[model samples]
Target: MPSPSRVLKLIALLLDYPSPDVRAESLALHALIRTAELPEARRDGLAALLDALCQGDLLDVQERYDSLFERGRALSLLLFEHVHGESRDRGQAMVDLLERYSAAGLAIDANELPDYLPLYLEFLALGDAEAARQGLVEVAHILALLAQRLAQRESLYAQAFEALLALAGVAPELAGQCYQAQQEAVDDSLEALDRAWEETPVSFTDPAAGCPSASPRRQPAGVEQPLQWVAQPVPQTHPRATR
Candidate 1:
């Protein structure tokens, strides 16, 4: 197994958008990985990815990253997108995850969601090593599916997910199942991509139409009750933190 620190650093670097700085960082990470005593296959896989990132044209890397991650939802970096897409449950999950981060004293930017893969890795980096491994295991299926999809696209980024699976101890049979399930979930055709972007009518105006009923109904004049308020704790901010 790779060192915990190295694994965390590699994941963070892999998730970043390719740039001159990232290219430099990839080179540094590559050197570190070369010296580490990891399994030959695992080390080679990660090294190959780092090599591609370091050698590829920056514009090409940016375009490929956008096409694979930005345009395609199947290979999204947001962990919850695969688990709970645009559902009320996903919103609740985010709220709960944010609370967990707060409890752990991890501050995230207002614009970044809690389920973002990099942010999640940052959180793990701050915790116990065993706990971090367990956290990765919790989402092993997602990583496995993403790796398979990226490999099909011949993306070097797929190695990052493969490394994650190794660290998370995902079984080959289980990974296969996860990959098959995700494949069955979406149509990867050009027609499907076009259809996904087609505009639909807004339907939020009608209160009685399909929307959930509003909570805390107003009381009649005679039944009015005194209002109660509960103060919410503000999230701590860290401007200097890389994550």
Candidate 2:
């Protein structure tokens, strides 16, 4: 079996936004996939996605990503979004997850939420392989739903989710149940999709509600806080009446 870290790295690469240098990135990604030592089916699925990404126009890829992930809540990349939406529960969940990342010395960028798929994958990539696999399995239902939705749209990105399911060792019957539950819950119409994104804002005011104060706070790695200096007036010695 391929190490969990290696599998996660490939998933993270796929989840990232296709930059202007995507062609070159795709080339490199393909090389990694070739030696990933994944099962034949999983490897081929990943390779197919790479081929599609490399062959497509960068603009189309960017637009598709935005439409699928950013504009629509049904396909949002943030894991908690699927579970909690704009509810207070989601805020609390985010705070708890942020603390977990902090404990692991994983520094998330200010603009990136800890629940984002790519960030989550990066965190997994840095952890114990067995633990990562267990974590992935815990979220297997989410992955399965994502795969089903993407496959419904005939998007190549569906392959990434499929690869994740394979890595997590999710049984086909379980995956089917997850997909069926998601489909039943989601309306999937254009209006319904739009409404899903129009969620009310969530605020975390109570310290007890979010990250508990009891949890120790550690500065994220690679971030430096500027030193605070208290302003003090310098004593001016009266020029000995040098008149």
Expressed as tens digits, the lDDT of each residue in 1-243 for candidate 1 is 456756776666766666677676766777777765455677788888777776758898877776667654566676666633344565556676766667667887655666667777777677666666666665665677677877777778877787776765665346545234333334557776555334121222235554321212232122123111111111122112243
Stretch of 10 with least lDDT, candidate 2: 234-243
Would you list the C-alpha lDDT of every candidate in the order shown? 0.59, 0.61
C-alpha root-mean-square deviation, each candidate: 12.1, 14.7
Error of 2 at 62 (Å): 0.4
TM-score attained by model 1: 0.72
Show where candidate 2 strays beyond 4 Å.
178-192, 198-243
Clashes in model 2: which pairs? Answer: none
Candidate 2 RMSD computed on C-alpha atoms after optimal superposition onto the true structure: 14.7
**How many Å off is the CA of 193 in candidate 2?**
4.0
lDDT of 2 by residue, 1-243 (tens): 456787797788777776655477777777778777567878888999878767767888877776667655567676665544445455556567766767667876554566677777777677776666666765666677778877777778888988887776775346546234243243557787667666431211235434221112323333232111111111111111000
